[model samples]
Structure formats: structure tokens, C-alpha cells
Target: MGKIIRWISWLSIDVVLGAVAGMLFFSKLFHVALPWQPYVLLGMAVWCIYNLDHLLDAQKVGEKLSGRRQFHHQARVPVLIVIGILGLLGLVGGFWWFGWGLELQWTFLLGGLIGGIRFLVLKFGKGWMKEFSIALFYVIGISWLPFLRSNSLDWSAWHGLFFLLYLLLANLNLLILSFLDQEEDQLAGFFSVSQELNTVSLILWIKYLMYGLLILLILVLVIIPSFYKLFVAILFLMTLCHWYVFNMDGVDSEKKRIGMEWAFFLPVLLIFLK
Candidate 1:
């Protein structure tokens, strides 16, 4: 079961599932009834993007690789093929289902442009903004339909707080992964934001992130309306799980990565809570 879960994480299936869970949770909170199309599109897009990133890393890294990188290195062709198919489906099906509204147009335009720029940057440029960009994109992708269906372009304080909580959780997950994988990335000649920080500094940053997230979670619990507080609490639990995994000693990076990956799925509980 452990190996099976690791394979699911390595293949990025867990990420896609977590996105779906997030979408459902946010949609329920906003009273938006999202159809099947957005879920499918988001799932495909996330899987494609993650697999492409892994595939690129696999090709770029040196012979010494982490287990995840080595898996990507060995399965590069098959993963690329899957990414290609899913990418095409997401593009075509998105247009067909979303229609040609101004919002849809701008969303796709910005998503495509940013996604392209991000790929190029990851492939060749520095990693300063990589974690944050990925986090923002993930939150936007999961919440786009909810925002639209809610039909309120104007964000209330509660809405903004909820969005910030999700973004903070996502970035914390990435930062933890980056910190844990720093040595492996260094050994593989891979570039990550961690490369810019010493071990002490990175640990300090992770600690600060956890404290910030905890503060945000508290604000959210107090400020968000009662209807959404349950969802926020679930997110808070997810954040704590990541923090615990990051602080664990004598654990391998792969296990920590898997723990973080699984933590994101905790929001699925919101569906039942609703």
C-alpha cells in the first residue's frame, strides 16, 4: 500500500485528486454548482503540468537523482505521451464547455501565457518565483469556476481570506518539499529556490511560514462566516499535517513528500461536512 501510494504521488495522480477536492470544497462554500467539465479540465491540466515539470527535471538532472526524479527519468516517454494527450483534451474541452465569455477568454489567455512562461523559466531560468507561481496557479485553477459561478468579481474580506489561506497552504507544501529535497536537488545539479538559502536559513523560512499560516488560520476562523469556518478548519488541519511532516526527524524525503501530497486531500472532508 505504501509503494502504491508513492507511485500515485510520483505519477501526480494524488495532486489531481487534491485539486478536485479543493474545487469541491470551495464550490460548496460559495454555493456554486460546478459541473463535470471544470473538474475534468482542472484535473487534466494539473496532471499535464506536473508530469511535464517532472519530465523536464528528469531530462535535465545529472545521473544522481532522487527516487521521484529517477522514476521520471525512466518513464519520460510514457509520461510525456500522457501529458500531451491530456493537455490537448484540456484545451479543446475547456473551450467547448466554458463558452466564449470575457471571463473565460481572459482566464484561458492568462493561464496559457503564464503556464508557458513558467515552463520556460523552470527549464532555463532561476527558481526564485517558482514555488509561489505554482501555488498561485494551483489556487486559481481550483477556484476559478467557483469565483465565476458565484458571479461576484468583487471579493469580500472573507473571500480574500479564504483565498489567501489556500495559497498559503499550497506554498507551504512546496517550500517544505523544496527544503527536504535540497540535498537531492543539489546532488542532481538541479536548481531550486532552496539553492539560494543555507540549511539554517531554509529551516528558519519554513518555521516562519508555519507561524504565518497558523496566524492566517486563526484570522480565518474568526473572520470567515460560520458556513465556511468548517472548511477553513479542515484547511487548517491540512496545514498542521504538513508542518508536522516537515518537522519530522529521520524520515526520508520521499515519505515526507508523500505525506504532504496526501495532506492536500484532507479538504475532501468538507464535502461530507457540507
Candidate 2:
């Protein structure tokens, strides 16, 4: 049972579910068939690989310093290998189906390479590199969606802005989890923003950041007025669910379980309501 729980935690199931919800929301918002459902699944696989990198690094650090393993030894290596292979396959399959051409594929490949390098660097790099890498991972990963959505290599400001907002929300979710892992991270010599700032200040900052982003989203809705009241209400309920998870302490297992399940359902709700 403990091992099962650990596996679920390492998978970051809530994050994957949230990504699925976001993708579905985008599909509805744009009225695009998003023939890229496979890509979204692939994106989740990539996320699993990226997360495995973190888990491996954490375990390595813990073992070296304390002479005791931190993360589950039996599961760590196998999960990492499996997820890495799946991520690679996902990338290839994504390119093949999406027909984004070599240039765009290369761009996406570069982002994945950066993420891999960042994983290694976090094991050895210092100060700004670590901080910069964390932010970069979020930017690159979220931007991959809009980039993949494009029919050509050419970029547009509208898509770029949307990607940026998506990345902001992604980082917001990550920061919340980082807060929960603050002690473990500090012990592993990881210098996350949550660790650098005071706890209360960190929480306050995250709250304001989320609030500001939501307000901006509202402004966008006002300007476009594309969605209906029901759509807005559904979005609001989704945000409320996320906020509930964000406020929960210590990565509560029950909350994680329930939140993961509900996150997926939000997109389904949008599909029906819209």
C-alpha cells in the first residue's frame, strides 16, 4: 500500500489531470478539434520523465549525504526508465501525427533536451542556473502545446501570449507543490523559491499571483466575450477546485486522490456544459 501510494505521488497524477483539463478547455475555447489528443498524452509522458529526473536527483542527493535513500529505491529507477522511453516515443508519435515538420520538431526536441540537461544541472549546478532552469522547464513545456497547435513553424504574438498565460498557471501549480516539498527540497540542497523566501511570504505571493492571473483571464473574457455564462461558471468551479488543492497542507493523500480524479472531470464538464 505504501509503495502504491509512493508510485502515485511520483507520477504527479494531479498535474497530468490538470494538463488534460487545460487542453480540453483550449479545444472548446478555440473550436478546434485539436487532432492532438495523442500529443497531450505524450506531453503527460514527458512530464513523467521530467518528474522522474527530479526524484532521481533527490534520491541521489539524499543517499550521498545521509547514506540512506530518500525516495523509493525499487520504484525510482524503473519508473524513470519507463517514463523516459514513453516520453521519447510520444515525441516521435506527436511529430508524425501532427506533421509539424523537422524545424518545429527540432524546436520541441531542444526544449526536451533542455529539460534533461536541467535535471542533471540541478544535481550539480549552483544558484541562478538552478532557478533559471526551473522557470525554463515550465515555459518550455507549456509553450510546447501552442507550438504544437500551429500548422507551421511561424509564430504569432497571440499564441505566444496564450502560451505565456498557460505557463504562468502551470508554474503556479508547481509552486504550490514546491511549497509542500520545501523541507525535503531543503534537505536535498535544492534552492527552490519557496525555500529562499519566508513561508508566509511565499504563500502570500502565490495567492496574489493566482488572483492576478485570474483577473487577467477575466479581462481577456471581457475583451473577447466569446464564451457564455455557463462556460465562465465551469471555469470558475475548476479554479475553485484547484485553489482548494493549493491550500491543502503537507500533500494530503486524500486531497491528492480526490483532486486528481476531479481535475480530469473538469474538462468533461466543460465539454458537456459548452
Winning model by lDDT: 1
Model 2 misplaced regions, further than 4 Å: 1-7, 61-71, 91-100, 103-164, 218-223, 228-235, 248-265
lDDT of candidate 2 over 9-75, digit per residue (tens) = 4565545655556666655544445565554664566467556765666565744432113443445
Q: What are the models' TM-scores?
A: 0.91, 0.68
For candidate 1, write residues 109-171 as lDDT tens digits.
878888797778778776757788888888988887888778565456777778888998888
TM-score of 1: 0.91
Question: How close to the true structure is residue 120 of candidate 1, measured as C-alpha lDDT?
Answer: 81
| Clash pairs detected, candidate 1 | none
TM-score, cand. 2 vs. native: 0.68
lDDT of 2 at 39: 41
Backbone steric clashes in candidate 1, count: 0
Q: What's each prediction's clash count?
A: 0, 0
